[model samples]
Target: MTDYAFSSVNQLANDFKDAIKNADDDQKKVLKKAQAKFSLIERNYQIITNLYNNNMVDEQRPLYFFPSSQRLVAGKEEKGNAKLIVPFEFVGKKLYYGLTATGTHDLNPMPFNPRYPMVGLHANALNTILDNKLIHEVSKAWVVLIIIILGVVLAFGIPSLSPVQGGATIGGLLIGYTYLCFWLFSSQHIWLDLFGPAITMAVGYLGITIYNYIQEEKNKQFLKESFGTYVSPELIDQMYESGEEPSLGGEEGYHTAFFTDIQSFSAFSEKLSATDLVSLLNEYLTDMTDVLLDNKGTLDKYIGDAIVAFYGAPIEIENHELWACKTAIIMQDNLELLRQKWQSEGDRWPEIVHHMQNRIGINTGQMVTGNMGSASRMNYTMMGDTVNLAARLEASAKQYGIYIQIADTTYQPVKDQIVIRDLDFVRVMGKTEPAQVYELISETGQEPELYKKILPAFHEALALYRNQEWNNAIEAFKASDELEDMFPGRKTNPSRIYIPRCEHYRDNSPGDDWDGAWTLTSK
Candidate 1:
């Protein structure tokens, strides 16, 4: 009997060794497969970690890791040994064992199965069914629906209440929900999906807030780009802060349009080298433009040597027409000073023997003013018949020899403050209705006594010319030209050109229907 027992013990030891060898080989293969699969899952885990770390989904909790020291064992009846234990240090926490006939039969002291109760088969079967039913119910479609509805109501309803009430409502709900979920999970071993709805709410709110912030910044940049040239920087910032965009479209308001160009600039530029001509133009335009800016006029556009600008609109000035007229006079005055300075410095200035003067034309009327052009290219400008008339008057100044001319339409409004001499009534180039052009002689403060005296005589001559007394009008113009410090030396010759033309027309009359208004056939 002792020999038999010893042999049996030896046989058991051999079987155990064989099993260990096979299990180790199987474990290695299983571990290699697990590592490969886990490697793929680990990469996904890293992506999730990075997203969470970046606060991409602020309310979602990060994943938890089970400790590496934990282990799992199998075989319920094996008292002092385990079939397999993973991460062996956690074995002491509590080893879960599955009962089987092999385990009870091999270690012959008839080990008990912890999984079974002493109760009959029906009771065990009933408990298994209950556990399965509970899992199924928890994972049902209705359960997911409930969670979604709860999230929506909380997110929308909380913000609808007063601030303090909303805060209290949300806080109380969050605390109660968290506590309930924790208690259910710990005591009943049931898992609740807390993170999903919370993440949805957080992401939706954050997305809207971020989008609005970006839009606001874009609006600020647009405002700065649009109005920087016309308004002060501080006021621009204030408008941006207040979120008000200035209307850049057309407005119905009175404004003065000033158009000016160098007389015979194209012919003059042909005589000089390109570099010298460009430099000269730059010098002249810079001085003139500075004067325009000083008078609070918007420099609308420049067409080569010509400057087209306006007063009022974009920002309104009460004396817009007055400002425009004042700027033109100042520009003429500045040019005289510039000519003297250039001559003293030994610069080759353009000849003024025949005619070389800036002829400015101003008109006040309704015009469509705004940024006008295609989507890709646009310019802030004023457009209408009034703008065209201003240009036509500028061209007309060359014909009649005047420094500045305003239409009768323009002169009517500011007649109280300005002294003007009616030069001519002509259907200027493109229009059928005759326009009376008047030279802006002086302002109320700087009215020259000589201009005041000769201006009345010139108008009387103009009235006679309109009535077909061409010979008498010529005599009056010649006398006014000779008046001391009246029309000046350079300007007198150009005024003299019109007298010979009038004499020729008078000699060969154009019948009773002729209105005595000269029409320009060509530019």
Candidate 2:
């Protein structure tokens, strides 16, 4: 069969009518053949009209049609139309019997199904418009709300999950929301924003996930550079996992500050060769630094021949003062062993190097800790009066001929756990207020009870000294010196410094307004 357009079909119909009117046998035979061919094609391929015609009563539906030669195009608006015009696109394109793959221009019916290519699409559109069943999209407010909900839900959920799980979550949400879109359109003729929500969910998930990964990587690098040298890898991991950043600002915190410096280090360095000094210093520092970090101390810095550190920073340790005291004791114990090791390696340096001792100072109080330095170089460190006192205490340790000294704030926390001696309340240079400093002896306060009698006498002497009774204080201090029979560990005698001061005070009595606080003229 041949394809036909609305114009060609009209021309053929006219030819048949006029040829018969002219009365010619050959023409009649040609017309008869054309009519038979048209009939045969119509019987085989013509589709039933899908539109409810205005000419027919609404209750009386036509189930079948007798194909008419004049009605070539099923897309005609009416049976009584006088105008012969049609869309140019449909001029040569064949009208389908019922949407066949053989031809094009099948817009008559919807594209979802292959039926009624002539009248189905038009009838469907007309029916939708007529019945008020046109799908109306959800409001802009609803769309925005849905986007936000999906974006928030996926953004939060994705980062907390593994990559595979996050992908799966996005996929499931997209599919589920799309299904809801289809269901709403079918059931209630609603057109929700399926594409919008799906895209928002996927985009939000990926954006948040990637951002978190990058931030985590950045934090790993930062934490490594900031603390990698001193703290253990495990501690680093703990800090990193906590997800707290150490930024450039200070905050008040209760922490224990620690400082240490070798005694006569300048004199010892003078004797050692440059190479030997560096080698010895490296070894000494490595061992001591490990002990400090093991006790959860953040190594603030190394000053020439000293180590400065603190506990309860970057990460808080509950018993920071106790840790500081224990770390001091540990450092002393470790240093003794190291000295023995150096002695065994004879000729490494002067024999006097084996007797090297480090003085330690610790204090506990409210201090400021964070990144502090010039714009070019920032140091994650601590500052405040508490920190200053700890440094001063380190210097004062040498004055008392002792290894370690801590302020009263530190002593109160570890008195039960450590053996200590009450030193004195003295005003260091640069400060107006007097602070009580004590010497830390050992972890165990229970021992030979060697300083028991001397401690009581020393307290009495200190009390007398504080009362401006210089003669009585000197007498009490001398009795204390006589009572101490045990070998002094770090100091030659605890009462020596106090007695000299008491003798001087007795020789020249002070005027009124003496708070009994000795002020050191030097740092």
Candidate 3:
């Protein structure tokens, strides 16, 4: 049988070679001659023709030699192309098929026949192309499997995960899929679609990622629009990070309450036109509010020309009282600068604008701090006696002609850091507790020369006044009042406020029950 096969192969091969050489690479002529030669071969031996010069046999339909008609015919288009990388090995002195260990199959179809070497080379190239087409067709099922796998996993998975997690999942899937395809092709001669599944995963991840990013930005914008004017930016960010909205609730905590009002806001309203008043208030409030936020205080609300804010709610500071005091001082200094600027702007503003004065009152104690008001319209604010006292202190500051007044509770924590003078011991309206009050002058090392000069005399006068030494206190207060004129910008002093009070007490004594705590009769 082997001998017959060789004889037939030799005869047919010789005819095909002659036909090929004569045709001089004309594919049609070669195919025509191949068909005639192939007719004499056994029925089982079929001729596979690669009609296209390129090795991709499956790109277009393959062509075949029909021995019965001695013609080449094109086959139906298939799923894959003929471009496989066939494996090989060497055994003994001959090259064999690398798929088997025993070297049972030869690399060339006719290994021993050397007369038609060109025929063997052509046969090997055609065999490789055919092998590639077979492998490609075989892998179609796997291609569908991968597409379904990636489509199902990524489509369902990406939406449930955060952007970072989604990206990681897509990357992991791509890496795993790539490795799988590479292993199958290199080790098992399987081909799988690489770009199709990868594209699916990337598109799914990107679509979800873009959606998530937009949602986050929208949430951030909402928070900014809702709370940007009232809450500090840092507090707003903290609220956002916590992923919870401010709800209606209250909790008691030790905090500092702040209240500020223009010294004569009503007068200004009466003096300037409505437009001019709003413009001035806008400028003044903007600058002062900037100073308030810079010091980490949360703005509670703006009641006309009055500003209400607090420290140690939603977030806490180590020493909230100290921060509240510092904020007050900075605001006053800022107002002074505004006053100077308004004064320099000529007569655009009334004389009061040139010396624009504001009063700030700060008190520290247990207070209820949280989102307050009806559910439909709520705000973050403070309530209780501490809050009331702060408001009262702000109103009463004008009585002493002082710009800043802090309760003794607020003064103690910041005593060493701030420069202050004892103002009075008084029970503000709506409260029975007679709290000691102090004037917040300046920072510790930054006190003015006049303040340093007047502090001693003022403090002595306060001690005597509190001790009920009314006649002596009056003398001390008068002496301190005299020192105010020595300063260049000698405005009214708190000492001048005390001198009259001491004179009243000396003339009309409050019986022995007077605890030296002056009780306020008005709000």
TM-score of each: 0.53, 0.61, 0.67
| TM match of model 2 to true structure | 0.61
On lDDT, the stronger of 1 and 3 is: 3
Clashing pairs in 3: none
Instruction: For candidate 2, write residues 252-343 as lDDT tens digits.
Output: 88999999988889877789988988998889899999999888889889998899999888777788899999899889899999989998
Residue-level lDDT of model 1, residues 236-302, one tens digit each, is: 5666766554356556567888999987787767777788778878888888888877777777878
Q: What lDDT score belongs to each candidate, Candidate 1 first?
A: 0.67, 0.78, 0.77
Off by over 4 Å in 1: 1-224, 227-253, 347-356, 484-498, 501-505, 508-516
Ranking according to lDDT, highest score first: 2, 3, 1
> Candidate 3 — worst ten consecutive residues by lDDT sum?
82-91
Candidate 1 lowest-lDDT run of ten: 80-89
Highest TM-score: give the candidate number. 3
Clashes of each: 1, 2, 0
